[model samples]
Target: MKKHIIGTLLLGGWSLMMLTLLQSCDKQEVFSYESEHALFFERWKQVSLSERYRLDTVNYSFSHYVGVEDIEHQFKINLIGNLLEEDAEYKVIVVDSLTTATEDQYTIKNPVFRKGRSSDSLTVVVHKTPVLKDKSVHLTLRLVENENFGLGYMGYTDVRIRFNDMPTQPTWWTKEVELAFLGPYSYEKLETIVAANEGFTTFEGLSLTEKRKIALNTKEYISEHGITEKNGDPMEIPVY
Candidate 1:
């Protein structure tokens, strides 16, 4: 009886080990890309990653371009397989149902993976119009299989761009900026600050002294002009 029990335990251990080995082999085969070339949209580094990587959704605005006529919005596309000696052409198509911009509002440029490069830029020419000021528009792009490349990583195959010319708060207006220099933010206060300091777009890259100086100047300007928010609240800057 003792010998039979030991034999049974040994056989079960062998079977479990074999099952694990087979599953490991299957996973390796799934992840292996021996000779296939694939393409995926690269995530922007400035944003935090959601799960394993950041989603390829980009938000753009023309409000930053005070005098520019048009903006060439660009996104990075990455290659998965080995680099080629010659340039490889890739194709991108717009999901019409998901896109809200008309043909005249934006133009998509041809995408190419340059020779010896692992990545390339996909550019879209976004035209600024009066309509964009009041409402936003969206353009969704997807990578399709072409002669030179295959769609890679289902999650990264698509990219969505939301663009507008509306006066929205800049991403640089973080809690740190408010606690350190700027106080509670409002569109009116932002406009007042920009008016006081020519081309003041961001609180970044400015020294503490410089930011304080500009804030003081803006405060004086607000007091002199009696500028108030759209809600009729007093416009104040806390630099002290």
Candidate 2:
């Protein structure tokens, strides 16, 4: 009876081990030939909006890379907004210029092992009904990895727009200030300005004379604009 019980336990353990190994092998096989690819898109800021009284035409330039070939991939675009609300109304038009190309010199329309490529350019127009007040709307584009036969990968981007007569201004003050202050300062110059600012200095002990000198210099610089000249230019002084 004891022998029989030992035999059964051994068999069960062996079966469990085999099953675990098989599962791991299957996962490895699935991802064995995986290739790295990425897709990205952004709205054109300069030409993104049209005149308030007219139809607004915009273009979104998309970029992507496929490391391998011979796989069929599908991309989908979705829009979400309150445009259909009782007080809001708008219409959208999308145009696709289907152009395909490979990153390599191999001009094969259809690739097998690691060949195949394509590019797309889309032109979109958003028309606001005269009755609708100007308002902001959000648009989202999603690229699903529909097929994964060890070929290219996938990614996506979502964009937001305001459909009103006036453009929406960004509410983040720090970003605006940073941009204004650093507009003329190179990274290196900004570093130097920060280092020269006494407020940024930390010492274990500051002598009375040293503190007086610092205070005098700060006052003189603020009153006579000496700091701006010493720093090379007002543009070189970082606001932060």
Which candidate leads the pack in lDDT? 1
| Structural similarity to truth (TM-score) of each candidate | 0.68, 0.21
Candidate 1: minimum summed lDDT over ten consecutive residues — where?
A: 26-35
Candidate 2: which stretches are off by over 4 Å? 1-38, 42-118, 148-156, 167-240
- What are the clashing pairs of model 1? none
The whole-model lDDT of each prediction reads 0.78, 0.31
Model 2: clashing residue pairs?
A: 100-118, 134-164
Error of 1 at 170 (Å): 2.8
After the best TM-score superposition of candidate 2, give how far the Cα of residue 183 lies from its true spot, in angstroms: 26
- Scored against the true structure, residue 196 in model 2 reaches a CA lDDT of 46
